[model samples]
Target: MQPIDKILRNYQSMIVSGAIILFCVIALIFAVIPSVQKIQEMFVQVSDIAAEAEGLQKKLNVLNALDEQTLRFQLASVLTAVPGDRSFPSLFETVEGVAARTGVVVQQMGLSGGTTLATPSAAKLSAADRKLGARTVPFSVTVNGSISAVQEFITLAPNVRRLLRIRTFAIAFPPDERPLTVSIEMDAFYEPLPTSLGTAKTILPELTAADNEIIERLGNMELITQSAEALPEPFIGQIKPNPFVP
Candidate 1:
């Protein structure tokens, strides 16, 4: 009903105010809201970083408190008791050592199960072995000795280092009071070392009293195999005043 010019003039202040408010709303939608979202994401990243740092600090503190020598000694004992791989040489040495100590003559030996030339991969393990997390190498050994010596051999075989379990055994009596022939079936246990470490946030496992007792018992076991030779010292190249100058 009114002229355009007149209506605009009458509502000029109100229109300017509305335009300012609309501009603010558009800015909030396009810029301010995005900025707020970015800030929130940054806060989340910082919190994650702080948590990771705290976890790493706790691990460092635990490492610092540990005695390296004692840990290494314990690890050596444990490895000797239950080697990380199927060490056939050490296993044979252990069996021979025990038989020697028990006054038994080893007549024959043969590997019963699995390939003796190479270690079996984890994929080749049976479901039960995978679940148990330990692989077994079955072998059989035949020995000739007096009844008392054979009994002692049987007793000592499982308790020696390079851990073994007697699965089955049979004895044959000779007619003329000769030494008895004993056939023993055994299984040696091995476990592979972990291929990867846990995440920084993962909690370190604490050794319980039972674990300590096991370690102590392993330490006391007779190590039949010879100790491994110490590693050679690392070579340090001659230092030059300027490494760039050949």
Candidate 2:
């Protein structure tokens, strides 16, 4: 056997052996790594399920302890009470009735809201601007009638549909008015009925095409803001899309 030949043969054997060992190692790693990862994933999934099951069990135990009356009340609170359909028309008729019965001449039953203002004082002004609710549509009813009639209307105002707060009421008797008429500017508050109010949208405004678009935008914006507000502070950060990932 020659030295050079022996050296080359030894090197070839080393290469072959190394290749076989490398193949065996790669095969073993591929086989074991998946099972290990699968076991880990299974453990994670089981842990999450167990935690959820434990929480549900605790909740079930608490619910079992609640009395029937309490549960009913809770159910009632969770379930929105169905409102009557006669709410708007009934309100209008009631107001008209008060005017007629009290002998008050309703010069205008104006509503001002959403950047629109009318002579009947139908200014589509928000309650916040008019200082009613944080966000609400308010109307100012101007009436020309006897002082007695105005007083009667004011007195009967507390019974209006929905919770109406008389924000502003003033009586003015002009110097040259006939029949000793008094001009009454009274503020009547009403919620601009929402689509999904869990109650009902109270004020039904007849909007033009542009006005309708504005109103819808406002409603959508309000919904988004409300949904955003309901989330935790940490969720606020989640709103802006994560730039790092697709």
TM-score of every candidate: 0.79, 0.37
lDDT of each: 0.81, 0.49
Lowest-lDDT window of 10 residues in candidate 1? 229-238
- Per-residue lDDT of candidate 2, residues 1-246 (tens digit): 599888878798888889999998997799878889999999999999998777667766655676857534332321111111112333344456667766877776755434333422333445465453333334566677766767776765544332234667666666775533443333333333232323222232333788546434433321100111111122222454664442
Candidate 2's C-alpha runs over 4 A off are 1-28, 46-88, 98-107, 114-135, 144-152, 174-246
Cα displacement (angstroms), candidate 1, residue 230, comes to 5.8
lDDT of 1 at 93: 83
Q: Residues 1-246, candidate 1: write the lDDT tens digits.
A: 468888889999999999999999999999999999999999999999999899889888997898978877787778777776777777888888888899999999889865445544443775545676778778999999999999999999999877899989999989988999999999888775554456757787777899999999988888776554332221233345664552
lDDT of 1: 0.81
RMSD of 2: 16.1
